[model samples]
Target: MNQQQFSSSHIPGLDRFWAVIPAGGVGTRLWPLSRAAAPKFLHDLTGSGQTLIRATYDRLHPLAGNNIMVVTGQAHRDAVCDQLSGVAEENFILEPEPKDSAAAIGVAAAVLFEQDPEAIMGSFAADQVIGPDDVFRTAVAEAIATAVTNKIVTIGIKPTYPSTGFGYIQKGEKLEIEAAPSAFKVDKFVEKPQADVAQRYVDSGQHFWNAGMFVAPVRLLLQHLQSNEPELFEGVTAIARARVAGDVTEPMAEIWPTLPKTSIDYAVAEPAAEAGDVAVIPGDFLWDDVGDFAAIARLNPAADESGVTVIGETPRVYADDANGVVVTDTSRVIALIGVENIVVVDTGDALLVTTTEHAQSVKQAVESIKAHGDDDVL
Candidate 1:
């Protein structure tokens, strides 16, 4: 709960680890800038002018060095490589097809295990923004120490509000690991709940926002895959075997289709709760998934009258607006005279006008674009 209480100095024998970033998602939620060809992670959403993937690589470089492996689809392989030129070429694991996070994790684990069977793997998303690097590093260090002796360890962010967008982890009694004093046994992994249910969870003071960051030993994770999801394990093993046999391209294409499109949460974390093999460490650092335009708006400096402006080619003019986000790419001047709680996005080819209340539903607009068969606009 406090700084001294969550320090990582107590953890000894922590393994120096590698990081796996799953950058293959087609982020439809962040459309216009995000498309099937170039997803959100490839875009510079920060307005600070850095692509999300580049920022993530910079953040991970300190602990994992050039050992960061990026698993992406064949379509985005070139773009991913271009963005991550600082990383070694061999570190990019190109998936021949997309099969969600489970398969991505499997591929990275297989590759890492082949090199160092005892290696601890820390996995992250390509589209997240975590601040206060020292705090994040400390949490990761604690997670690595915990994973070396546990089955799977996850970094859990303290819930700041009743958020419906994220999954929640129910915290159990604190576990006294040798290195970290604040690790808790995971009781349950709940999916996105309804508003009232989410409010109850927040009131309980025993829940955390599941940040989807995980750390685990290669062997232990492989064991869970073999025992629980054998089909996926077999597919992953075949891919690893093919890589060893010098037929790298054929195996990923062959095995990706066979693997189920499930998330690590449904396949591993949820099951681990029943098996009592999961632990949660409180992450006190500032973290956000940057899942939508509103989340991006929250990161910007607050303006007068609850207005947030992202300056670009077209300057934003807002008046008497409260809790609104305005973005424009066209040079055309746009002004909101009396609008409140609205999202006004002006692109040359397309324009998005919605309320902040429906920010998450922007994915529907992306679908509409796809339905119109306008891939360029999406």
Candidate 2:
């Protein structure tokens, strides 16, 4: 993992760069805490003062400046705007429905292409927690430089472990681009593998976790989309043209909800990789999608010898000899005594009590709640 690292001052920021944040996911894994209306990205999961999206913005502001656009569902438009007053009203790209990453990022790409035909945009998740801000920014700067070559570039996170929860990107020979010395050809993009298979991938020392952060020229991205998915490409292009014309309301309403449900990986990345049109830069910084309770616990500074991580502003949690976990989102007092390795999440409406081992099953609880017709809690 001896990838090149550069100081933030050394990395050049492109004026044509734009950051497209696709912010629409319930994060059902962090149930009770993460709701459909207010998902994980809207919350300060890191216990940092800023919300996840805000933190993401802060991290990218140095690289992309005010050239940022958030692509979110119509339902979340107000929240996204309220959370990001620094961004202009026109910068927000509200989708009519959730059509997954391809549509969301594609629309952003289309709009950026309209603004600047050669715009280089990086699509970063609104909810990821990076290990070091500098390393992340440095990797992105290099990715942007690499993207200028008209190739799809992604930050290939050096796999810390055999993580079954994340997709893996296999790297090929090193790219000889002087501007992006650490860049490499993407051999393949593999889906989430079984535990044993994940271990084998890690043991081989040729795989990197797919960080879901993609950087490329807008034209190149749309060209790939048009080549692999004409229908989707046409839909986004039409919407983008309307946006550029300043009358997207009617066309977007008619076009967005009908787009197919597909992730960027399946829709473009895989095909581009197959065509030898993708590049990956090794990223050694620690990155976490904060997918589950285990990942949540890892971010808690309070997870001490007793193992307790209390979230929220004024959560009244008292742990006497409690050893496991206690998370509260409300003002009500939660007392945990002599409990070890157990997770207690008390939202105002719903409460989740489970063990750390079964934390991944929290999504099942959300489904059970839905089955019980309790959408308000969700």
Candidate 3:
């Protein structure tokens, strides 16, 4: 993929920051194109010639230097190592199975805290598409500054429109910190709202789309997890301790799955926000989680006069009047006649046909296929 570079030396106070990448999830909504064996983060959904995780590494390595760790499933360990040559073996935290973000991030915090007492860790998803490097770098630099003051800081995307798919972060009082002048106290986190409610939030100018990105001192996170989720904290901490002692193979296998299956939002962010210990950095950049084909359509390059936005096999797709997204990894010609807002994903083993309106329900289709006992297709 084409990439832009940013100089970390120019930024202030990013020296002690370490980037933690949580690379899990199969991205079911973009199914057929995104599968179990090779998940979405492992693919170049943007047709940028670089996979999502690789792009994430490229974005963060300069800022964090060699202090980057990728927490991913064991099934993807080899691929993760292959793609990230700069990341050392010790920096790769391989999970036996999926335990969601809480466990994935918790372990990294615990380990980093032990390694460097002054370490501040920033946790970013491997699959998010970030636009405008300057904006992202500015936001992250301010976030790191805020985190040094011992606050759990999350970057909130400035809402361009009322989006019902993403959760909202309600910004409270403006913080008076010079390092992070644009930071504000997070009032509360609202779950993905109804259309009307989302519109109201947009009108109020107090809400930003939750991007699930956080920066905090490793000490702060470990302490919070220890107080709020003692059992989980104990398990992951034990795993980290075992790693420090040299053999984590056995303890990680035992403790990882035993940790609770929940998100970091539910585990820490909500409670911390209630206590006024969380801060929000207003992110003024184009960002997309790329949750479904509809989101992918918007991120793709603009469509031709015929109106179809195409990715992958661009030369093989012929659009007459179709006006949505068309993705193909196969050799067959994909001809779109008159379909509007439709999604056609052509893969070798299976093909998916749906509309942007119904793209979120494609997960249901995967379930239906599984119920029919076609594991091979999945």
Q: For this target, which candidate reaches the highest lDDT against the unseen true structure?
A: 3
Q: Which pairs clash in the backbone of model 2?
A: 324-341
Best by TM-score: 3
Number of backbone collisions per candidate? 1, 1, 3
What ranking emerges by lDDT with the best candidate at the front? 3, 2, 1
lDDT (Cα, tens digit) per residue for candidate 3, span 232-348: 899988999999999999999888889998889988888889888899999998899989999898888555687788888445888776788888888889888988898999998
Number of clashes in model 3?
3
| lDDT assessment of candidate 1 | 0.79
User: Which 10-residue span in candidate 3 carries the lowest summed lDDT?
Assistant: 1-10
Q: Is 2 or 3 the stronger prediction by lDDT?
A: 3
User: What are the runs in model 2 whose C-alpha is more than 4 Å off?
Assistant: 1-13, 303-305
TM-score of each: 0.91, 0.94, 0.95
**Model 1 per-residue lDDT at 285:** 87
Ranking under TM-score, best-scoring first? 3, 2, 1
Tens digit per residue, CA lDDT, model 2, 213-276: 9998888889889988899999999999999998999999999988887889988899999999
lDDT of 1 by residue, 3-79 (tens): 34332244443434888999977776666656677788987766768888888888777667667888888889788
The global C-alpha lDDT for each of the candidates, from Candidate 1 onward, is 0.79, 0.85, 0.88
- Span of 10 residues, lowest total lDDT, candidate 1: 1-10
